[model samples]
Target: MSESYAGKINRKLLKKRRIINAAAGREPADLVLKNATYVNVFSNELCHADIAVAEGLIVGMGSYSGMREVDMSGKIVLPGFLDAHIHLESALVSPREFVKAVLPHGTTTVVTDPHEIANVMGTDGIEYMLQATEGLPVDVQFMLPSCVPATPLDESGAVLDYRAIDSFYDHPRVLGLAEMMNFVGIIAGDDQPVEKIVAAQAHHKKIDGHAPDLVGNDLNAYVAAGVYSDHECHDLADAIAKLERGQFIMIRDGTAARNLEALVPLLCAKYADRCMFCTDDKHPSDLLEKGHIDYIIKKAIALGADPIVAVKVACHNAARYFLLNNRGAIAPGYLADFVVIDNFQDFTIEQVYKRGDLLVDHGVVRDFPAPEVEPYLAERARNTFHVETLTAEHFSEHRPRGIIGMVNGEITTVDAGYSDRIDVEYDVLKIAVVERHKNTRHIGIGFLQGYGLKSGAVATSVSHDSHNIIVVGTNEADMAAAANRVVELGGGIVVWDGGAPKAEVPLSIAGIMSDEPLITVNEKLEAAKDAAYALGVNPGIDPFMTLSFMALPVIPTLRITTRGVFDVTQQTYV
Candidate 1:
């Protein structure tokens, strides 16, 4: 029979019949996992069951004969983890390589906001991410980026207005509008943002939110505008308030920001269903050393959270919030996605099965064929690093009373007291943000006090919100060399010392991700970190990741952009 004609037949009915036959032992199942202890999220209990899979759905969860069977003796079977929110671009690897890195860690699903790419390449960037993630072992879902440039205060490479955003509403992989980082616009009832929210609602799609420290009437107004979820809460009070206001809170535990400790208290039985886990931005080093949602689960358990509730927060809560009804639970008719672990406490994933196919075995990811990269994607490599000229003079700035701040373990920055000059004695350094998108030759110069760089410089084109080139250094010559080197590589992170490149990780893909494998990317990142440490950067912070956030103008207190130093509290250029 022709494949088209065969597909046109009642395949749904035939699949249902097959499932019924397999469960009834009249037909052999495609795969059977026997002698396993299932962590049933639905009932919040453990059950010894033999899982029978037909096609790609759970046909039954009892002793059954099958065409193929694997004895999962003494193993604990849990649903595959779902990362509620993440930025795949932040991994510094393409979606193809990112899947390879996280599959062994048991992350089978991810809902990603491609705003980082959208800010750089506009709608074309969003489409590229969707196309790249097709047919992967992990279930990659795209959340339509709500804010392309993030805010009107700064310029991005491309703009995604309501008209441009509406085009992806019907895309099969599009879950909803991404985190609306432009909370200021939404609170003010701006026409552009308000219209986007209405369009998402009209299409019955959920809208994610990104309001950091938003409270009082403003928070109410922001939520009232139909923004449904938030992943930026850093404390318990804000988390409690958002939960009370009917917003699903994504407890984030990533390399830069670690809020899981403070928010773990909120993951109690009372709010277990409303809380989910997300790594908003995690580098490959962190993703590999510490697992994704699996890491979050381990931390939550260590913090005295119930093991079952922690698992629910990692798996069930995310699935429920995203309306992924088919894969969160190990029940009949659900998608056959399982994470086989030794126990719930340590959360050591031994094997992972997606759609009845084993993808990870013995804690190592089974190699799956990667999708072909279209030739047009290679064309995007040119003209990304558009900086014309960068010099030591660009890093010179005199602000006796101007103060910039840095916060530990958080993206938010605070103002340290003003300084008379670049006080290298006290660890103050010169920070510059160079505009790379339009070759505007615009550079924003300021002083940062916490980098601890006594000499040399660090630079990256992976700046947040607006992916400009941002560099910080003790000496202007090193700063100039580092910034120019980043532009030279098209885009990536670089650390320089003694007026030469110390270490570099090239992210040639839209100047945000490397086309290299995850292992190579991780090695480069580690070397970059070592170089930063050698340059006297504070060991407490991930220098490259921290430098990336310094350019984010949306975060509070003080931030630098290509336009100028922005006071986030005052919401204007200082």
Candidate 2:
């Protein structure tokens, strides 16, 4: 009992006729904003006009009458902000909770890569997020995880090949392949990476990149393989090099890697068009305390970036890059998504509208239906941990081939060479990555410097790219206890000391996110951080957030995996 193709076409034609009539002033619009000064993204300037809405589309931008009107005489109107790249699971909250935190800040759309959960639950995790984000006020789109296991060095919960994810390309909300973290493999012409790239290219999907310091011929090869964009640019030089070689730049300003200040110079007339704003991985505390994309805009303006250009990068540029052409502008035939603000200086968001419906007013989101979670998916996600009980003997590894030295404010690390003795007095600690997915009892033991952990232990199942259970501690007993506690909670971060848990944040959703409210998660995360700091953890770096990245082998100089400590620069086991 469905309409025929011709019938559907006729129905859409009728709706288009109504929209044209409304724009031509022959019919009353559903809503109108009177005397508005809106940002004209095409013209790159602010223009005064009245915006008319009909059927949730901006049908006109001149004088028009509507059934309902809101006066906007002195306020500034902008297209709703879009996050070019983000990991929603990094917020440590479910899609519903994450929306509540970002919607008030005027982030009406986000293009996310669910690789974090996909590493733990595979395609089922991707399906869970797709269902969890449907029908929310904030439009959530997806890019399929390009590197689920990240690389061959890391052993994740699941291995995603091209055949494993080919059906996802047909999804309406799926944009393309996510970040291609295996740049080395691609440059070397590896078959696995090449096959995935060729498959996505065949579907005409955008392929995102993650080449950090790649330059010269290697960079050319990466772009030649048809990668469209990159969010891993850490400096202006790196971004400019990629931009000149035909790749869109995603200026990342996130929790562990704050690259906005370093790349602020790229927000100019010459380069701003190719740039977009993204919080690649924002933590719970940062999302609640600091704003989302709105925070990036404010900081860009503060760093002497032109207000108008910054707004364009935050809104229109991302929409254009992601090919969501319908909702990024205020012109006719575009969706009526907007962010009304007091001014650009404070960048204070006053009201937000999504498809002509007022979703947020005066820093508060209106009531809407939360996405329905299927009972089976919810049960499957709640029980992702599959590790056997652990003892202190399992963590007793004295010899470490190499040590990972943490960068103060960045996720990138250093090859701190090797040391046989555990020097607790010199801020050296023991770190281990336990393979919790298959429970093969495979543990990679290594030493860590600059973590500043004097005593006790901390463990989290939120390790990046792989989502393995990674723990760091002063001794084997505390390390084993902390890691076991994480398994006991199904999946979570635990801070243990004196043979007891100090604080814990349970992430029952695929070992990465919680279904609780944002504020509650933030409270628990902050308490856990405090407990970590009390145990002599570094105050400069986020304890759990930074620890989570130690297992990501694609990042930089050195990293850890379930196999062993690997030197990323040399591409070999240390």
Candidate 3:
């Protein structure tokens, strides 16, 4: 049923012979780019040559002839961009649709974590994403979710221990364990997280970190436990500390948590090699309207970073860190994946090639077949929301703890201690977290300040880590109505006003992603934002995205869970 070792060696030898023949110009290359000026990653400079492609591998870069040729006289070719870290599920579309949005932006490869879906569907969600991304023109690699339920304080649909994900390490696309969000657990030598770190090390897989502001001996303990990278640094000192301690810093510039501007100093020559670019949670609107990694590269160049250094951070550094040896360069023996840009200053992508095949031409991605998902997985993903019907009384809170204050432009909240006043005029609102998994009917009620909601309610099943239904509103009735609407839609974001849903976007797949085109998802999201704005939500913060992070118990200060308003630092209910 399989070839023998000798047979495999002979087959490889024969292929190598053919590649050598093409390189020596004894035989014609399958395709060649004539008069090309490509970035030489090895030399850290631009050079002129004729690139030869055969069998999807770059065989040579000197004078070469091919059966088919394209004259690329004036264009500049840089290695195709690679996203160091991202959660593809955060795009709120299927992998196929996400690829369509980013391919034209010159993102030929992405390393994604399916933790959002994993928190909902468990291993089934991971399997669905793997199957969905297989065989696409853009390469999709994975880092298994290191913390499924995130922590013991919150309730999630499923819990994945290391034993549960050990088998996934064998998959070719699976790089390593994803962001280990349980930094506290790992530092304390907790059995659960320690075992995971040991297992990843056993397989020689990379372990990523998520310690927001860890310092001193605690940071040392976390790094000593084998977590090699982090994307959560929000300042220069924090990033530099981690970099000096041998952790690769990922400069994140996503829709919700943007740290690129603060971490740009790491893009300089002193620390550039140890840094990479990532968009941890890019919403559909941002992806479609602005751009993907290309947008990051352009922004970096505009922010006083050298074009070559920025490009290297976007491509080569990430590839080397992730151990993807075949790509991230435009040299011999690498995969023929690169982007043709007009120039370094503007960095406007003109064309994109993956394995020598033009996938995006003139900013338009060619149509491709959507990946087939297993019938059972699709059926399972659609039925993720399991909650009972709720009435206005379910959201009623007679006694309230301290207000969970919303920080402008940040997910971190502050403890604006006990406000007994129900003052809607001072921008105070009622916020509730309903347990949607297991139909527990558990609800946590609290008051929120700085939301700026004058009337109506906004609810979403996209709550972070746990994904419980979180709603913020002026009245209990409207909050109940919004939560009920989210459940009725199977799973989605909803804005309810006047006893009805004003705008909604259904995410049927694991209550986090849609199978529809990204354009449709983006349009729906924009409409939802408009509806929230009309209800008097703050103009500065993202209404839905800000609400989604309220349930996550890992972040510092105060957060809401199915239990109640919690103090993350003290590890207890307020």
In each prediction, how many residue pairs overlap at the backbone (N, C-alpha, C within less than 3 A)?
A: 0, 0, 0
Enumerate residue pairs that collide in model 1.
none
The global C-alpha lDDT for each of the candidates, from Candidate 1 onward, is 0.86, 0.91, 0.90
Q: What CA RMSD would candidate 3 show?
A: 1.6
Q: For candidate 3, report its TM-score.
A: 0.97
All candidates in order of TM-score, best leading: 3, 2, 1
Query: Who is ahead in lDDT, 1 or 3?
Result: 3
- After TM-score superposition, the amount by which residue 175's alpha carbon in candidate 1 deviates from its true location, in angstroms, is 0.5
Ordering by lDDT = 2, 3, 1
Q: Write the per-residue lDDT of candidate 1 for residues 288-403, one digit (tens) a residue.
A: 78878888888888999998888878888888887888988889888999999988666778889999999888877787776765667556644566777677877776655445
Give the per-residue lDDT of model 2 (tens digit) for 1-574: 9999999999999999999999999999999999999999999899998899999999999998899999999899999999999999989998988998899999999999999989998999999999999999899999999887987778887999999999999999999999998898899999889899999999998899999889999999999999999988988899999999999999999886789999999999889999999999888888888999999999999999988899999999989988898978889999999999999887889999999999899988887777887999889898887788888888776664689999898788998989765789988888889999888899998889999988899999999888989999999899999999998888899999998999999988888888788899889999999999999999989898889989998778889888778898788988
TM-score of each predicted structure versus truth: 0.95, 0.97, 0.97
| Residue 115's lDDT in candidate 3 | 92
